[model samples]
Target: MSESKPGFRPAMTWLHSWAGLVLGLLLMTIWWTGTLSVFDKEIDRWMQPETRIAAPEQRISADAIVERVLTERPDGTLSSLLIYLPEERVPFYEVHAEFENAESYRGRLHPGTGEELGDEVSLAASGFLYPMHYRLHSGAVGYIAVALATFMMMVLLVTGVVIHRKIFTDFFTFRANRKSRRSTLDLHNVTGTIFLPFHFLICLSGFAIFAGWYASIPLSFVQLADPENRAVELFYAADNDAYYSREAAGEPAEMLAMAPMVAQAETIWRDRYGVEAKADRIDVTHYGDANAVVEVRRHFPSNRTEAHRDSINFDGATGAVLTNFEASPLRKTRTWLEGFHQVRFDHWPIRWLYLVAGLSGCVLIGTGFLFWAASRRRKEAAQPFKVRLVDTIAVGSITGLVLATGAFLVVNRVLPLDAAALGIERAGLEVRCFFYVWLLTFVHAAIRKQRAWMEQCRAIAVLAVSAVALNWLTTGDHLLAAIGKDLWPIVGVDLSLLSTALIAALAAGRLRSKMRQVEEAAVATHRRDMGSPSGAAGTVANRAE
Candidate 1:
């Protein structure tokens, strides 16, 4: 923290720049996807039109749904089943069950008719964006990479604060009209300063969410002491002893009516906890067995303190209450940290706020890249290979990601509904299109050099517009129609696409204007050189002398 130390600020500055630049693109991708995940359910609703069923007037019977699932699934296949009751955001009954051999099934059910809803088009907001944000869908390696990036982000944030002695003053110091490098630096400083606490917490909580994965040394010691995995059990221990014991009888019996069980759980919750508890989900284990257990998880109001801890279990066959479990204080603290990072209990306003904060983080990283490139422009001209390479990567990563995401949305809407029948998995195709387009953008950037930025911006604008159009052509749900129908998810997505188009278009225009200014300046400099004696006459005079 001592500014007087020789080379302290400069060393810290170098660390900040290199650290941010090295992983900036990956961080941007993670941040962008994480931002979208704030409203992932809404995106899922927009993507999977089959899931946009209307809420039922009367609650659907869970027993009937269970029967339906049993008939559809193979005999003795279901090991466990989870039923997510319909809510305002997700209006279709969702069933997720695990099979005997580790296979899983997920499908939606019509609320009133109790019929399975077939998805012709596979939309992947939840499957793609959410996983990509956290895991990159690459399993363990991706998890390690993301964790390392998150740790680096924390380092950059701390080093950034240490170097910026005028952090408070810089919060109000944005000079937009200055030279590009200076302006970019100012913006980076301002954003980093203003949202420092948020950026720190987001990074910390993100790492903390997977703390067990990263903090394996201590966990290994704990595991060594408790070979029975009691440490793990204690970490996730339930409030009641019955949570761990449910002896299934050899004889099978039909589950008791779910309506009564649900009513009983609600009554118990309200009477005991003084909170109106509506069942958010029902999870049944040992289904059809004599000692089958049904757990009804209640939807509590969005209180960060609660940490989503409200559930009552019942005897699936007898309709008798079993156990109610609440989180321990330690577990609740972990849940609260996770809730802060994931925003699971947040409403629309707070969700949007999280999105904006996430976007600002992206901006901070982006401006850092720009500042590094712009500052080195003149010095690197003699051997500009490294600078050009970084420039291409920066362009491809920042704008290419936007372009690729827009193309992904467009592909989702443009592909035929029965794409799987045509030998192409619809969801996989969308993901492939995204990465392919992104990879091509990198090639395009390398070829086009500085023009790549403006070109990709325009490309992104076109893609955004096409996505909106394709959504309308495929779904017959234009923005105006969606608004009229009060389908805010669709409306929000459409408006957001349009806004993205406008922003990209405007950026392209400004970049073009800047390119023109650079050309004019270069032409003037050439003319001045030729008109002066320094052109050919000065060379001839020097030779004669």
Candidate 2:
């Protein structure tokens, strides 16, 4: 409500604090989910344990999987089909298809046998945390909101750097044992300063990936010059010509085998690029139509910079190469930026680094909220309504979300496989359980006030430990068993859950101790004031005299 000082730095500082405070919670949710999405596939394997097949020495037949999918579809009415080949990390072949009425089906098959893998009603990675990270599961509206948050994040990062007088010095400074407010501020500064470049580029690249939706000027101009519906078509166009459709040839024709087409694609990649690239995914469009096309996308090697760009399309009938989508210089730059942001090159070490950077951002935003609340606590004592609201929201958003996620994982294990007997889908029940727990945390926070942080932290600790316990109870796959079986993904997820519980427990203990210290300090101040010569009791006696 007050004007900032008449200086650039002061203006930036004001912007940094207020802007961050307004959107910091949403940013934290996005970052937290995005961090989890870095390991979405691993989590998928952990959740859908039936898909945990051992990789075979010889690759399975793609033709057999395609034939099986076609036979399994309802009356052979296929709109489009995608087959994700099995690899060492993901050892199950996956087939996904769309129907005429926008309905879709997905199934996993054993790499060695082409038999169905899991009947468990699982959303796997795509249905759970991955979608939340990108779109918050709210479709178009959520996408716009996430993009706006990313833009504001960029603004906050830039303004934070501009306002900090000793950015470089702060990067090397942290005083954890100092007073609460000072320690919180130092952490905020250190995290923001140390990971500034990574944070900046990740935000910028995320915005650039969806630039047409948010920054519409360039797209608007292109729309004016293009056909009326061409703008919409170009907006949804894929890298290849797979989306194009043609009328049925009026005669049903058996499709060509996919194994030869896959082998040919690999040969082409080796011959043209001089690299032994494997086709990770194969997409077939208009499967029975004469104009059907097959698109084979190469899996980028970890050493390659251009990861998502290499793909070859072929005529489904003749198995002849149709087109190889090669990136231009600008497109290549964009691809590299996205690849870096998404970390799809399959490097675990780099992925872990991304997770660390993302968590640091979370800490930075969290401490910023704490610093704001703590700095205003004394001044706003008389009318502490706003401070209390922020404190409640801070606890609800940060620790509450963690608690809710743990509940979700636990519910995933606890819910019956046929949850439909209760007229609720198992996957939907898991999601509902998450929201219910999260909403309850806000209610608890309002009721408990300042104690909510400790309460929620303790709740999170309990829920996290319970999640791991439930996994063991339901699957009989404890960390030790998972490790013995060489199921690193499950082992990692179980260990991570236990580690989270430990951290939450420690945090709860720290908060309890701090609360005691604060109570003692307040009592000491009160006793000293009451015993003073001109204190409340002394003033009353003097007045009576």
Candidate 3:
């Protein structure tokens, strides 16, 4: 106060602008990948053609699938087996088995035929892009980065509203016809202000999804004396007390058929919820032993907004219900937030809306990057390298990131099932394509400067269209074929790719026009300076492209 300190609004303004600028790149990556992950399962189906079949009217039995799994591998003493039953969205049986020797097996089977699918050659969205959203595929480090970014996002949203004197007005105040810097700011304000509540909630819910990580902090201290890292295990053990398990008796027992047990569990849930309910997964422990227990878990139902995994355990031999587990109140609250963030509930309209909101987050973050670069370029005009560097990063992160994703999809379609090099499988090769293409975009942006934006947009358009065409060529599932076969997931992905191509092409054309205008202006300024005795030092070219 004695020295005339800045007011609250001014402090918030500085915080908002600087914080956003500092972590904007990370935010954009998270937001874009998160947006794509809204339909990760759909993308999975589109990428893996063997999983694109329609749901069978008459389904195979859970008992039969289990029997087949055991028959396929008779050597190892069974440790545990998981059967993921088919649903409307994913119409296939998936099995994962673990033997006492630690050998594991995974396969996808046809719903009607129960025939195991060929080996999956690709690590589609569920494996890659979805994880990239929350973890960046870097494990603990990625988790921390995303957590920090999410926290900063919430802070930015608050500071942005405080600094924006006309926050509500900004919702309808986009001036698309204004000058470049002003319109960019306006667009940023509009997106940020329009989705203020949503942005806040999404960020907040993200924290809940990672609540376990936060819990590990205190639990780690609690387990300081232990040699093993059991903080997470302890956290779950205390919170998940309802789970029931029994040790193997070592006496061989013919386990009751799992089909009846599965039906009984579904019927109980359906009766309790007054709606259709089905077992999402069945987990078995100590198979072939008297104490073996079959646990059936139901997710995405039994409740809509909790992401609750309601489970019921049945005795191995008699198939009698052992424990109908229910989560604690605190657990339910966390799960509710998890469900809200995950959007895995059974609602079609809201699912599509989540997609729109997620993309809007991408737009909000991208526009913020643009606004900062544009405003800074004017004041830092003399530092050409600095301005160009900022422009290059902006171009590479926004358009280039998206272009890399398009290339990833295209490469997935182009690579043969047996594609491998230097011991890397086809899935690993596809990941390499994504990273290498992304790295090249940065180099390309630095070389092309202002022209990079338009050039990359064109590349994105080509890659997107090529992905769709290649999907048709390789799988013979064009838009029409998918529609005829009622393969809506494939159709949805194809249409989205075409839409992306169209949008990228349009953006390319606009950038080309803007580039022409900038060059023409620079030429005029140079001509004016050439005729003067003492030439003006600065030109439009020095300021911006």
Top-TM-score structure, candidate number: 3
TM-score of each: 0.89, 0.89, 0.94
| RMSD of model 2 against the true structure | 5.3
lDDT for model 1: 0.78
Full candidate order by lDDT, most accurate first: 3, 1, 2
Selected candidate, larger lDDT, 1 vs 2:
1
Runs with alpha carbons beyond 4 Å of true place in candidate 2? 1-6, 71-79, 98-104, 215-247, 299-306, 524-545
- Model 3 weakest 10-residue run by lDDT: 533-542
Tens digits of per-residue lDDT, candidate 3, 125-161, equal 8898989999999998999999999999999998887
For 11-54, candidate 2 gives per-residue lDDT tens digits of 88888888888886788788888888777877787777686556
Better of 2 and 3 by lDDT: 3
TM-score of 2: 0.89
lDDT of 1 by residue, 310-381 (tens): 678888888887777766667567667777887766377877788788888888988888877765665565
